[model samples]
Target chain A: MAEQPPESARTLIEVVPALGEVAPLRPGDPVRVVIRFPLGHYRVPLYLRGKTGTVERLVTPAIDNEEEGFGRNAGDRRYYYRIVFPMTEIWTDYAGPPHDNLRIEVFETWLESARHA
Target chain B: MHEHGPGESRPHDEITETGPPDYFDVLETALEELLTERNLIRPGEVRHQIDVLDSRTPALGAKVIARAWVDAEFRARLLADGRGTCEELGITFYDDTGLIVLENTATVHNLVVCTLCSCYPRPVLGLPPDWYKQKPYRARAVVEPRALLAEFGTIIPDEVEIRVTDSTSALRFLVLPRRPEGTDDFTEEQLAALVTRDAMIGVVPVTAGKDGSGA
Candidate 1:
């Protein structure tokens, strides 16, 4: 009988970003952000897409996945960047009171300065 | 954007031009593909499971947790091993694996998120809220838990050290939120009335509403 070919094993592969270090953001400056997933990378959030928001404050500095695992030390504390967005801009046709905004803590690397369009 | 490349026109070309779907949509696709390829589950079965899971998230489990929070012995059994104790109340949980129950303390609160994937207590808690699956909430909750709680209308004093637990492993979470004020000697049904889905997730405090008030 002819020899049988070896069977290929099937597995799910998820690509993640390499971590990196970065500077803090100015009040109006955009801080780059990245989404870290145990499974894989993802876009930061739906509400923030194509919308300009302000940086409220900086919490901690930890890792950036782009350059390498910049802040992924097993025991390192992560820095969270707080960003604010007007609710009306996010939820289309929202008929709520004016000036109701949402503040979301996004890590660095998932954001870029929105050049006024 | 007409970003399509030469190979992009091919149905198999998912890497370029074709952008990814929304968060929940992506989850739905992944689950569908997984089941289809494995033949372990069918589309109809998946929908059925989703419906079943959604219907299970009423105040049932929350009521049980509330009762345990008030009763020392029941609470002890709940703390010792939730699986055995849950059986006493006809609420069993084993979404194909063993279960663990963690109570919420005065200073600490627990919220579960399957950062790696959507690992939830489907049998006990049912479908997760839309916000739970968002990347922003999942990523932020672990790093800045208290802030996330505030977004959900929960405000804990600065003195309380809020701990945000990420459920990235096989283990699941059940929050035994602090008993809301003003309802001592409340019946089980009343206590259960106070338990809300948001409370179980630690986003909102368990409030004993009108039903929970001693009549």
Candidate 2:
């Protein structure tokens, strides 16, 4: 499910339903970015699809940017999670040391619970 | 090494007048003029907004960093709540976007990037450099940050972890670089002058010279 996006990427940003209000995710919880490339205005980078990471923080809930990108629903609030992925996990041939990592803010809809090793 | 002072025009600034206008440029002009014509926005509002944006510079962020370096209480407040702490210093937020200050320490170095879009801390730092908005830096910053940073002459030791922060949501990030050594007696203003835009962006580290300007 973590396959990379095709080179000839087409634009198909779908303004889907925002995730419903649920239990808040806490720091250190394992989560993976949902792997689905619809080609539209997605904030989740292609490199992170299906890759698991630990939650760094539960940032303040904000309006969903996917809908806002299409100038549609602007008031629908969605939680944004700060997830941190180690460089080794992100790139198979990560040249840097194992200590390097990347943290990014992903909306609730783009994430799913993952099993912790 | 040269700096562009306020009112000194850059090459891109004169694009509309000199270079051929692109599709987005035409769209921007049309929207701006239409807003004025329709009385939705005042004639001078656009220019005023531009002036406001231009007024914000890295110096504003530098002040925040220097203050944090010298003052412990302010540093705690800034780490806990970046937006509120910045507003306390009179740094205005023109948009709904929020700011997050990522502190760099001996063990960890922080770098900020917006992989999806060029979302930046514009209120504190005037504008992002052209290279920041390009695809190479955006893509490689997250994938191979060490190599990308090395090109900028910032060689992070293996012991020190490199953490790249991607600004995907409304939150914008600004790196608070560690104060260089031997500046213990330097005044706050002197320390502020040492802070650079690239350092704040996490591309470079701040260094002090032997000129005794600060000490």
Candidate 3:
């Protein structure tokens, strides 16, 4: 059989699904939802870390930055997928408008099921 | 080695003799000093690799979004590898960053904000608008995205989930908003018409109203 020529030098790339490969919660499944921010280690937004909420949707699978060689560079390039709690659930006095929500897309590594759960 | 007064006017000649260094002078001096001391982010031939952000072309990511709107496989690739796929569309992200491109599908919505400092992806999406840079928008968007979106005229139904994307890195985001209806076989420019600065930022959906062109 004629050997197929070496693959073209073109770069291989793909968009990560909002959440990459995380098994979705069956409507009633329990999850520790959280907001994720993308930045260098020197600065992580104070409001988001370690806070807990629930996942709203699992849209699709995507590239995992951890496996990608970018390192923090990986973190810098793209964001992880997530949509955590509603506004009321996150804040006690979020009195700006009616039924506001703060859903976010976060990387998988940032999440861990709450011990309380 | 020159200096300028704090709030005093000086002629160009006087200033050149004793004023703050322009970029060229500073670069020359700094490079000489660095070579004399230590070599770092080297200041050699300085082949100015200009990664020109399309200040005139609006947010280039919008075009990618529009393409995803019409092409299913391309959309899948976008969802799979946003930065890589963007490269195919000639949207090369800056080094020291991995990009995440989120789709604003019919069932979902996306919005972006920078709460800490204005860390945006200037490589592909140009600069953030004044509103996006304001402290109010930054602090509040992550706290109350829906309310903020409403202020921008995007009223998401309770049934549909809204996802807020906060770009903390100088890593910018561009929303691939669900394509509007009645645009089958739309030309790239026509499709581009549906891509707006607001849509890319996720402040609002693309529309052909007011400007009668884009969202």
Across A23-68, the per-residue lDDT of candidate 3 in tens digits comes to 6343323356345555534233566566666665443343454444
TM-score of predicted model 3? 0.62
lDDT order, best first, reads 2, 3, 1
Prediction 3 global C-alpha lDDT: 0.61
Please report how far candidate 3 places residue A33 from its true position, in Å. 9.0
Better of 1 and 3 by DockQ: 3
B94-195, model 1: which lDDT tens digit per residue? 463334565777755556555545656666677787788878887666445656778888877755545444453334567777887777777767777777
Q: Give the TM-score of candidate 2.
A: 0.85
lDDT-superior candidate, 1 or 2: 2
- What's the DockQ for every one of the candidates? 0.02, 0.63, 0.24
Question: Order of candidates by TM-score, top first?
Answer: 2, 3, 1
Q: What CAPRI-style quality would you assign to candidate 1?
A: incorrect
> Alpha carbon lDDT of residue B118, candidate 1?
61
Query: Which has the greatest DockQ?
Result: 2
RMSD of each: 17.5, 10.7, 9.8
Instruction: Work out the TM-score per prediction.
Output: 0.50, 0.85, 0.62
From the highest DockQ down, the ranking of the candidates is: 2, 3, 1
